[model samples]
Target: MCQWLASNPNELHLVNRMDEVGSSKSVNFDGARKMALKQIEEFLLSFSDPHIFSEAATSSAPATLAQVVEAVRIPEAGNLICSAAAIGKYVSMLQNPSSLLRACAAFAFVQFTLPGGQHAMHHAGLLQNAGASPVLRASAEAATARIESKMYARIVLRNLEHLQSSPSTQF
Candidate 1:
């Protein structure tokens, strides 16, 4: 219980739910846990850059990791959940605190959705430059009038539209 509270200072109010041995039943801590999760989710959404994640996935990386990372983006949903979940997984995979700090530092330059926030089109950032086959890239550029357009850019645009209209979004 103390450990949880220490890790989640905002959840300190729920400490009373702990057992006499200072251990809380999972069910008893549900609310606090949920709140902590929501907070983490919100924080990640506001801090992490999906653009970096997507770009890294598509770069010349190992196939196995690329496959998993490519699928990290949410389907039919534009909310920040996908980015948050990916960032959480990324944080878990790091072996050193410096890596986490570096990631956080890099995120400082990316805008996001939040009060007084400026990132109105999060998808735009992710699609800034998309690598794709020459043929597909030519096709998209032909249609969009943007000569440099790529297939990844087109797909990202289409996906963004779908996500915007998705009814599951809360923000």
Candidate 2:
């Protein structure tokens, strides 16, 4: 059920229902684990090569909305060119639970801003997260703010207000 939804573009319109479905407790833990493992395997093979991740991110060529979503789903591309020291630093930071949350938030910011700015028209697609911390959610919102503002000042202002008052998370 979840796999079909995840892979289907039509399911995006049924987001509310999808959320309800995802939030329901799973009755089959082993089945869920097996499914997750299968998806990961498929996701890995779906890419032409993992090395392309960093190349795609740093490339100046404009990316479509679909490409941006692909980048966010698999951030291993960002790490491809990062130095060993940088990787160690990230690993060390992830060791702390709080820092991990903050890192996720920061990652969300980079994901939205870089893709839309560096790439183009990449804002058409929405961010997707099955479960993310409050800080991470806020970070994505902030990134969204930065992106929309680049397109429209009025929207930027309105979103700023919306972001300040609302604590809810988007998909």
Candidate 3:
């Protein structure tokens, strides 16, 4: 059911929305958005910091990342996540020693700026400004990267390319 919803463009926005609604407090949408994005950004950045956790204790990191990936599939989340700081953090993950972390960052980019996603252009602009494309291109072209990671990087690059040529996308 979750997979089906995420695959469907009509339902994609609700993956994050449903989670938010269930956990939502009595706060305005803007405030709630800020809080949620802040938490998500912190969680993602933590992965890039080796000092934050001992490797032996992060066994469930993949499972936790899967949930985070699902949680930010909405356009609103994309808008919030395109901030320079957030994008830079993600880029650092892209450059992490762990190939798994790099793959996860690429996957997050795919979800965050899905081609038809309302904020894709803005996210693309920020990503480009943060110099993510070179990193992504390297990831995609690297023979050493796992096939899955390479493909996710390719997908994100493609989405950004598509958005760049899009007449509606303004700098």
TM-score for all models, in order of appearance: 0.24, 0.24, 0.54
Please report, in order, the local distance difference test score of every candidate based on alpha carbons.
0.32, 0.32, 0.59
Model 2 residue pairs with clashes: none
Clashes of each: 0, 0, 0
TM-score of 2: 0.24
Indicate the worst ten consecutive residues by lDDT in candidate 3.
4-13
User: What tens-digit string does per-residue lDDT give for candidate 3 at 63-166?
Assistant: 44333334434444443335666666667767765565566567667766776676678789889889899999999787777444565576678778889998
lDDT of 1: 0.32
Q: Residue 89 error for model 1, in Å? A: 16
lDDT of 2 by residue, 94-146 (tens): 22233222232233234322322322112211211212123233433444332
lDDT of 1 by residue, 1-171 (tens): 223212332232223233222454334555664564465445435423455545643453445333422433322222332233333332232211222222221122121212122332443323222221232334334433221122233343344444456565333
